[model samples]
Target chain A: MSVSITVGAYGVAFGAAAVANGFTVVQACLLSLLTFSGASQFAVVGVIGAGGSAISAIATASLLGVRNALYGVIMAPHLKVKGLKRVVAAQITIDESTGVALGQEPRGIDAMRKGFWYTGIGVFVFWNLFTLAGALGAQAMGDVRAFGLDSAVPAAFLGLIWPRLTGNFERALAVGCALFAIAMTPILPAGLPIIATAFIAIAVGLKR
Target chain B: MTVQIMTTLWIATLGTSLIAFLLKYSGHSVPERWLSHPKVQRINALIPIALLSALVAVQSFSEKSQLVIDQRVVGLSVAIVALLLKAPFPIVVLSAAISSAAVYNWL
Candidate 1:
């Protein structure tokens, strides 16, 4: 359950990345507090790191975040709480917390409530903690790519998606989309694949 | 810019929460017609696969992706190998991370 918070800890790393990329410490810290999704944060920072415009980077990260669309759908019933609380529930519903919440049974509500709250608070705390840590020692972190920690993001995604592989069709689709994205990575914008993934998922769903 | 940033943050929050809530809530109704068929289950399951593949491509592969490969390729390969060897997923991830670093430094 706390694994969800691990996603948050990546916040500190992201803060460091953001500062290294030229955002003020306040900007880095606030991004984590406000934005919570590590992949999108990384994607945003990666774009800036690569010298892309800030607006473009923000758009890319936000686009990449579209997967949360499906996560939202997957989580709605589990959390079961509604109205304004629905709004708060939505904030912490990232891949980790959603997975923990959705993986359970009718206890999903209990799980969602606890998991979401716990993970959300945990991430919030850790994200800021690490962000501050990272910000304080930005230079030492070096090239995140060189440390290979950047790879954890996709590895995490694989962990998030691995359970969905149930057949040849699914296997083929996952491999195909991954390969396709990889091939066009040089040309496609950062967030495009996220949209492609959702569409592809829908297409595969309909095909089935 | 603060207003814009805050607004972007709000929109992103509300927009994503609503979407995720929908995805989570949709599970409430498994759709009896679909549940009745194995074919449909097989198909329904594929959507996640497609989504995952799209993610791997976005995160791992690129237009700059080379047929010759590089650290990420090596890292992913190492992780896949670890997974096949039954390393826990986190371990697999860590191994991949380390290998990518090794590959990066190697070059």
Candidate 2:
């Protein structure tokens, strides 16, 4: 609950930034409700806010979201969720739920599934609730740009992704991808450069 | 929002949602042996780092279709330093937003 709430509260920044970027409060809230992934949600607004086309925003967000699929694969056998429950399980298959599930490995599969459900539902509830709060707050602000809330999107993204850089290789890989994306920004279409960074990952992965 | 903007937003959100759902479903369906392949594992691990770095770059350095270095760069840099110092997530975001507003106002 603590982890989910604390992490979910950052949706407020996203809410404010989404509105600043021209997303209606309803659209912003819907993104949180449906998309449900922090990095991907931010990527959508980040790309769209910066004037990238919807196609580009979707492409960028989808690329970041590939991980959730991998999470599903890891949890599928353990979860054994079937029928309509499978759909629900898929919806909550994010980093926290998967992490909590995996972290309970020693306690056996039932405990792991329980951890996943608790964290997943906990985050979903809090994340959506707080997203509405943030959107409403940003809407009330009226011209969030005057407050320089536009910058919050990028900064919030930085905060979300920073802890993931746990090793020298990861840090170097991130910097290299960042440079490549920046260099390509002037030449490529708005969202293509970020998508292009997938090649960097493939190259790094192949080398590994 | 105009019809165009509304259409675009719906399309993007729904498209993204569909893609995410498909990926998750495939996870349930794909064979465990195929998933356990070393190459697949490596790509999965590295992809997030690459994508996020790219996002940070484009978000901070680009505005619309043009490349424009601005106060967002300053905000990201401060956020990075704070993150390295092990500041909490909310604080990192708060500090970065503050620094960004401050720099923009200063200019």
Candidate 3:
């Protein structure tokens, strides 16, 4: 429950950031409901907020979303469902659900399935609800920048990536990617720099 | 002009949603061996780190086509400190915003 709520509550930042980026409250909610991936959802608003072309926005958001596909691969065996249930499982197969499910592996497959469902559904509910609350709150604030909500965008990004920097290699690669993107920012269009970072990862991955 | 921009945003929004769903579903449908290769897995794992770190840099320091260092840097620093101290997500984000806002207002 704590994990679900913690992850879900961050949707507030996404919601506020989306609105600050010019999306309507309904659009913010729709992104949460339909997209349901925090990082990708943030990428969408961030790219569009920066006046990026729609194709750039879509590309950036879709790239960030690739991990969910991998997660679905990991969880598919444990979640042997069909038809509508399979669709639901795919939709909720995210970092939290996969993490919680795998963490429950020591107990048994039953426990793992329960962990996945509870956490996935739990996060989905809380995330959407808080997204609404955040959108309404930011909409009422009139000027989100004055409140320094603009800072929340990068800070949220930092917070999301911080946990993943588990070792020296990951940390160094992250710094390199950040510097590269910053260097390219002045030369490239709004969303392309972030997209370009993928090549760095690809190059490093292939070299190893 | 407004309608055109809105149309673009809607297209991006729907396009992203469709892709996200397909990516997730495709994982379950595709053979595990296709994505389970070590090189593929390693690159896949690193992609989010690369994209997110770049996002942090671009969002914190850049504005449009220009690189501008402003209060957001202060905010990001505070956020880093808060994360190091193991602050919760909300605290990290709030403290960063508060510090940045204070700097913007007072300094």
Candidate 4:
């Protein structure tokens, strides 16, 4: 519940950012409702808002969405849903759901499944609700950036990713990827640098 | 002009959503052996850390085509330290916001 509410609340920034960038309230809400992935949704608005092509937006969003597929692989055994239920499950398979489920490892498989269902549904409900609230609020705020909300996105993201850097290799990879991306930013377009960072992981995997 | 832009936006949105759906659904379709492959596991473990780190760096420092370090970097540093100290999520967010706001106002 806490995870869902806090993370979903960040949708306010998305709402304001989306509107500030020229998306109608309806379109912003639709992005939240249909996509339901915070980072990818942000990527779409961020790219397009910066006057990049829609192709770049979609490419960036799709690149980030690839992580969900990995979460799906990790979750497949635990979920075991079939047919339409599988699709529904897949739709809600995101970072929070997967993390909550895996965090229950000490409690066994059934707890993990329960955690998955609870967190998935919980985040879905809260995320959509907050997205609407954010969209509506953005319509009223007029100038989202005068308040410095732009920084909130990266700050929140740092908080989200910081806890996961458990070991030296992970930290090193993260630093290396960050430096590589910073270097690439000058030569590549906005979205490509992010996508290019995936190669660092590939290289690390190859080395391993 | 408005209609053309809207059309492009909708198409991009739909296409992006479709790609995301397909990626999620493919997980169910892949064979167990393929998923369990050592190479796949290694890559999966590293992807999120690398991707997110890149995101943090890009979002914090990059401004359109150029990379500029600004108050957001300070905000991110404070958030990282707060997180390492095991500060609550709300506290981490609030501190970053407050600190950034202070920096923005004063400097």
Model 1 TM-score on a 0 to 1 scale: 0.61
For each of the candidates, the C-alpha root-mean-square deviation to the true structure, in angstroms, is 6.4, 1.8, 1.2, 3.0
TM-scores, one per candidate: 0.61, 0.93, 0.97, 0.84
B1-107, model 3: which lDDT tens digit per residue? 99988887898878988899999998888999987888988998788899889888888888888999999899999999999999999999999999988888788
- Candidate 2 scores an fnat of 0.66
Identify the candidate with maximal TM-score.
Answer: 3
What lDDT tens digits, residue by residue, belong to model 1 across residues A153-194? 456456555656666766777788777655655665544544
DockQ of each: 0.29, 0.67, 0.79, 0.55
Clashing pairs in 4: none
The lowest-lDDT stretch of 10 consecutive residues in candidate 2 chain A is: A143-152
TM-score of chain B of each: 0.66, 0.90, 0.93, 0.80
- The docking quality of candidate 4, as DockQ, is 0.55
Q: Report the candidate with higher TM-score, 1 versus 4.
A: 4
Candidate ranking (DockQ, best to worst): 3, 2, 4, 1
Q: Candidate 1 residues B1-107, lDDT tens each?
A: 66754454444434433333443333333443433355544444454455445655455553222333557677777766776686666576778778888878877
Task: Write candidate 4's Cα lDDT for A84-184 as tens digits.
Answer: 99998898889899999999989999999999998888888887777777778767866554455556666656665677688899899889988887888
Any idea what lDDT model 1 has?
Answer: 0.58
Model 3: pairs clashing at backbone N, Cα or C within 3 Å? none
Residue B19 accuracy (lDDT) in model 3: 94
* Higher-scoring candidate on lDDT, 1 or 2: 2
lDDT of 2 by residue, A1-208 (tens): 4696576668788777777777888888888878888888888887776667888888878877878877888999998889999988998999899999999999998999999999989888888888888888888877554455666677777777677788999999999999998898888877788878888898879988
